[model samples]
Target: MGIDFYGVLQVPRNCTDLDIKKAYRDLALEFNPEKLQKENAKHVFALICEAYDVLSDPLRRAVFDQYGEEGLKRGVPGPDEFIKPYHYHGDAMRTYRDFFGTTSPYANLLDYLQNPAYECMTKHGKMFQQKQPPITHPLCLTLHEVFFGGIKKMKIHRLVYINDEKTKTEVKEKILTIPIKPGIRPGTELLFPEEGDQNPNQTPADVIFVTEDRPDETFSRKEDDLLMIYDVTLEEALMGTTVTVNTIDHRTIRVPITDVIYPGYEKIVENEGMPILDDYPRRGNLVINFSISFPKYLPKACKELFRKGFELAKIGGGFNQYETVNKLVLADKILRVDFNEQLPPT
Candidate 1:
């Protein structure tokens, strides 16, 4: 017999629906069918599913709990027995006709041989058959067009070959927009059937919308959340200030800054932290990871300013400047900072 269903699921016999659901989720992560193929893994997953299928329903759980494994097997019917040939109506009709034929079956066979017809038959007979050639077309979509969700018009060329004749067909199809809900990661595929080809009998090929995330200059994906990084100049970092940053929503809003904001740093915050929740929450705070870009051809005025700063630092107190440079070059000394916008729960 299998292990106790409740014990295998790691839930008490009196566990609530929510508790059972959580247990199933935890087991699914470990025994995902697509990931594990070993015999043990498959057996474990099957047992887990069996436990859940029974426990999830109130009636099944009650019956199983009361009678154990024998209750499930009791009064179970066995496989059906094979019927005799004489029992079938179609077989009985065929037998009656064979017993009643007045002439011997060999009489017709002897007549074909007695005549010259048997010798006149050709060894090989041929028939002409026509085949329809399958065709494939080209489909393309921009990253932005699929993300926001709008109708897409596609032009496809088709080549039909019937017998020896060739015909070119061009068709324009409008694909209805599919809403790509936010928080779904890139590479998610949405398939729609009967929208690709016009074959009535054959199953129509699917129109697939593959999510290709653009090489974002400012955004990153973080498990159901979109992270965005922005650069803050030295002036803004030194004196804590608030600045308006643009987001996917196309609106600008003020976000407070602090000295803790530095380059290559991450700031994670809840959607509730943002002042702009439009029926639903959008992105939270901008992860202001600083980056510096210097022009190859510097102006004379700017070049001289650096030279003067270098000369003054060499003569005056400059130990801190050297230490800062050393820290930047050494990976061991690099620092990570997080400027969280939301407060921790009590």
Candidate 2:
């Protein structure tokens, strides 16, 4: 059976990283082998270290969460770098000494362990390797690429140690491959563990790729729905029209609009929008917002024809008795032209 890291840390699965750190600190102080009198103190202390080691790092924690201990200890079947598991150093006393920076595991550990500015001194005055902050980069993905899942390759340069003794270092280029899945939203991040600059004293920083959607000219995405604009003349809007919509999947759909398009009218073509990736073959609706264009000037003859047409169709409208407003006024004062632009169209 796999060990429950959340149970060991006494935290919820969705708990924040700070919660895990605080839990480990309290537990480590209590179970330090040098301080505890129990016979199982070493075993318990080692378990705590192992759990903290996995939960502290984002990459390791994600693997442990998804595949449990078996997948984490043995490699998962993939080419992605995130699947590489980090093993515990097998020295609980050393782990404790490195973290609290104490001469002895339990000797006055609480005094300076919380101090941020103090430089830690380990056993025999040897400092432990420190993990560095992650280097983050924006990954802009086009809508086309997002619709069709593919792999993206990135070449990055970082400083690396040349010798095992940590005597020399040089810059090296590393190629990172990220697999982009269909329907991945903006702000999804891919973590490449410890791929940043290398130093003798510090562990390299993890590289993070934050996903962002590139601006598209023809379509805009709103959650799962896709929006498109179609132009229509006033005559077509009143009488109804049929439109041929060119979809992202290269399908041409002839949608018939039989009902009259009133002001602020919008039509929905079902299951024609963005793909629902998790639920394969399912899709959201395509929303068509009609933009009706009015003629600049209406001739007297044409206007008369419109009135007769409406009367014949029995469309209820007081066309002859309609009130004309030259300058709109509110509370007996004429509103400015700029203010009229701000008003919703009737």
Candidate 3:
């Protein structure tokens, strides 16, 4: 009934939201007024946009299904609020811009003509220009830069059409400034629409910048968290330790290790890692891994003295209480060592 919105989008009345979207994308690409350069294209795309907007929305689709196109356009009562009448904003490019920003970004496009007469100049038929493949470049950032948000300026060399007839071209340099938000994940891509070289008889391509984090020797990143390896002497590992560390963001923190720093021990500093994306003033934990460094050489007398001292203190008395250490270790070497590699009993 009325305008047949479903027919405009080339989708069935019982079509799914995904089907509506697919049909809309196809039609939008086919009749995108800017690319097609036709007056009729503008009206076609408007109907396509209106069809997509109504069908893709569940509430709107329900209203439109219950009531025909005219009824939906005349407005209806809703569960919570009164639904407004269906109307395309008449700016097809604006509607297409909304879709282009969200979807897979597969669309042929050229410059948006300031003059409306340009739409009429292509009188015979609307023609779509094929855009070239996008160029990808890595935007390398230091850990600190990723922590603190900043702007990065990049230079691009592109070929521009020199003449009105588009026969001659010249190489032009452009600087694109990209904003680096805090806690932006690695491998995130930034897209610059139609900002590439325009060769003769060919349209310009899009530019994409992929974010990459530079390696930090002191601190290693694990998602939003960070891993810091701190070294401690054998004495400090046995007794106690405390140390101050300079964070990547240039803040010094003192960590106390009152408990014995056992091997493979970790200290977690909360909210000290990379900043959380979209949530400012929040961060992940900074995990400090303890690396114990033992002295290279210890004489038998010193070793025995330390063992006797431990025995006197009644700390771990029966763990290694063998009478003769050398004979015991020598006895167990063949039996205990490399059990997997040892020969089976004959």
Worst 10 residues of 2 by lDDT: 322-331
Tens digits of per-residue lDDT for model 3 on 226-279?
A: 888999987676556787889988889998986667777799989999999878
lDDT of each: 0.48, 0.76, 0.76
Q: Name the regions of candidate 3 deviating beyond 4 angstroms.
A: 1-128, 309-346
Off by over 4 Å in 1: 1-177, 197-203, 272-286, 292-346
Model 2, span 229-251: residue lDDT tens: 88998767765689898777778
Tens-place lDDT digits, model 1, residues 287-315:
44455343557668545645665555566
Which candidate gets the maximum TM-score versus the true structure? Answer: 2
